[model samples]
Target: MKDKTLLFINGDAPKSLPSPANYELIACTDGAFHYLKRMGFPLDKLAFISGDFDSHSGSDEDMYEEKFILTLDQEKTDFHKALEIIQDKGFSEVDVFGGSGGEQDHFLGNLTVAFAFKDLMNIKFYDEFSEYYFISNHFTLKGAKNRMISLYPFPSVNNITTKGLNWPLTNESLSITSRIGTRNFAVEDEVSIEYESGDVLFFAGNKEIEYPTIY
Candidate 1:
């Protein structure tokens, strides 16, 4: 049986929330739970709420005590600790929301955390503007015609090649401080990307496209 995806909400609070019915389980950090409650999200749908509970009051704790997961590790971010809980629960595919807004450093920190767990699970991040994730060395994206697509090297990528983009790369090298591929669009329905080494972050424009099933 195919594992149903886990929907995780972070602290930043997305402009919109995805339908909970699409996922097998729904979870959020304490920070995100506040926004979700204000937005009238059904708390019963959450499997567990994980965080240090620094912002939660006594009554708040009393109400959802069974669902609260106290993660007091000061070394890791709540986002990171939450993923560890998900991993322990045996869910490998996760769709994250509210990870990109608020503070820029937090956004970058979320990306860093996602990168750390990329090998353990399929983690995709969604925001109002786009859905992005770390891609394997070779990836094929479909239904991307006329949409903005960005292939960014986390730090550096080598011997990169691509097809079906308006401006394709062939055996090219991209580095963060040197050269990175961004603001590129797909001209065809399908796009293929291959690279010899290093990690690549793929960003697909969220407008007009159904949530991609290819992931």
Candidate 2:
């Protein structure tokens, strides 16, 4: 990790990127390095590459070995290994791309990691249409005033309350199998969210999501 790091966790990322990208840290997990190559990005731009190498072919391994490689055990996923490197460097915030566009299990695992480390740093999982984040504390959402914000429990939501939303909840206990906060709207400049006791994930999105497809 560098002063700033952009870690890719072996998922599907867009082919086009902003010119003179702002990532001070470019990281990849196992085959994510190869994915970067497929996107026409240079490996030299990566500060670190880590993973269990479970999906890496021989040629892919050699290609990534030209740079930094941190081979991990099967016990931990590639995303977890990348998090270790990120957290060890004391980063305050991480914008994770390519996480939500991969295998279903890995995508869910990335969400778990974001929730587990919510207190450590601010993380945002980027997909094609939206961004997902687990909120452990108070935060303000600012963007298009008409943006759609949905809140869902991570199988253990205790009590949640909200303000400046279309359908506000007040100190309500949410169940694991409930979609109580789905499809809420932002009514103010910034919607305030507060929750206690359980994990809560908020998805702010506008575009329609194509299920099971990373393209």
Candidate 3:
């Protein structure tokens, strides 16, 4: 059995969280832990904090217990380091909060992990404006009503379809060239998807906001 896991990424992006203190979270890199503190979040709740620690400043190290830090090397990005730690712990669902807010390359790199690990784990990226999730099987998005939901597939995605949206898809095919799945709105309180063959990446947002370079 896989435990529910929440991974926090402190990228150079903007964010609006429901609460500063309440969440099941794990820190991906050093910067994410810094962002969590700035947001008034409790660092004690993190299961494991993994990263190279090269980004860790003197004050940053003081904020966390030395026992909680799992320092990884530079061969892998902090995001991937965090992923390895989470996978080792056998976590199924992961929500990346700070990964999207940082540097441009960092934000893009986090997205790549979303595509890279869609099959291995249930991964989602969250920011103030939008929440992006990848679905290989059927799943539900429950939250505020009238939220906008868009589904996009990677280059490998093929023969996908969806239901319960402004534009319903019935046995439709998708690919990188065809982004017909973009910009969709949720009709009710929840949105769902069922794949015919490949994997589906879903991005849901209330509205578009200025993307961040680092969170």
Candidate 4:
């Protein structure tokens, strides 16, 4: 949490305020800035707002003049733009909220953007109930046994293995569209995930994720 430097607020963040200690820089996409401010965020905490400005308030224009960068490039999503800026600033790790709990299309788009940046940065997405991230290699997720755990493959994966889960996979193949791992439960103090090829998105039902002993 404190180690994370950037916080990205997407268009559909939880209505409750995220703890300020979670990040040093606050960035928002689409009209999330308006949403955050309306939700009682102090203006000074914001670093910048980036989006196509298709849904922002007219009143916030002059207010965020210097802080707002109008990115009219329709090719990239706001999440991508924010990551690019974060990378340009020399920081690759970011915790993003509001990736889900929104329109179905937007939520899925956010997931795609996260995978797109998997090689570029350390990215995590936070929603009201859980935080999610994708891994191309071996990964560990620590949580209490019986808590919810989900693993979804990006199209396809090979030679996947797991430990500390109620139902474990040993060198199994899982695909996103066809065979997905959902509604799984942790069975030990920590859950382990490893795969030989492709990306898998791991979901922890809560905010705090314990590191793998080997991490």
Say which candidate scores most in lDDT: 1
Please state the error at residue 209 of candidate 4 in Å.
Answer: 15
Any runs in candidate 2 off by more than 4 Å, and if so which?
Answer: 1-3, 15-20, 54-66, 206-215
Position 133, candidate 4: lDDT: 90
TM-score of each: 0.92, 0.82, 0.79, 0.88
In the range 93-166, model 1's lDDT, one tens digit per residue, is 89998888788888899999999999998999988888899999989999988778998899899999999888
| Candidate 4 lDDT by residue in tens digits, 1-215 | 23454565564757576677667677777567766776777766777788887776677556766888788888988877888887777777788877786578888888898888889888988777777898757687655565678888887888899998777899999997678897677768788888899778888786434434331
Residue range 78-145, candidate 2, lDDT tens digits: 77777878887776567777887657887888888777778777787776666788876576777635
Scored by TM-score, the top model is 1
What are the lDDT figures for the candidates, one per model?
Answer: 0.86, 0.71, 0.67, 0.76
- lDDT for model 1, on a 0 to 1 scale? 0.86
Deviation of model 1 at 142, angstroms:
0.9
Deviation (Å) of 19 in candidate 4:
2.2
How does candidate 2 fare on TM-score?
A: 0.82
Worst 10 residues of 3 by lDDT: 206-215
TM value for model 1: 0.92
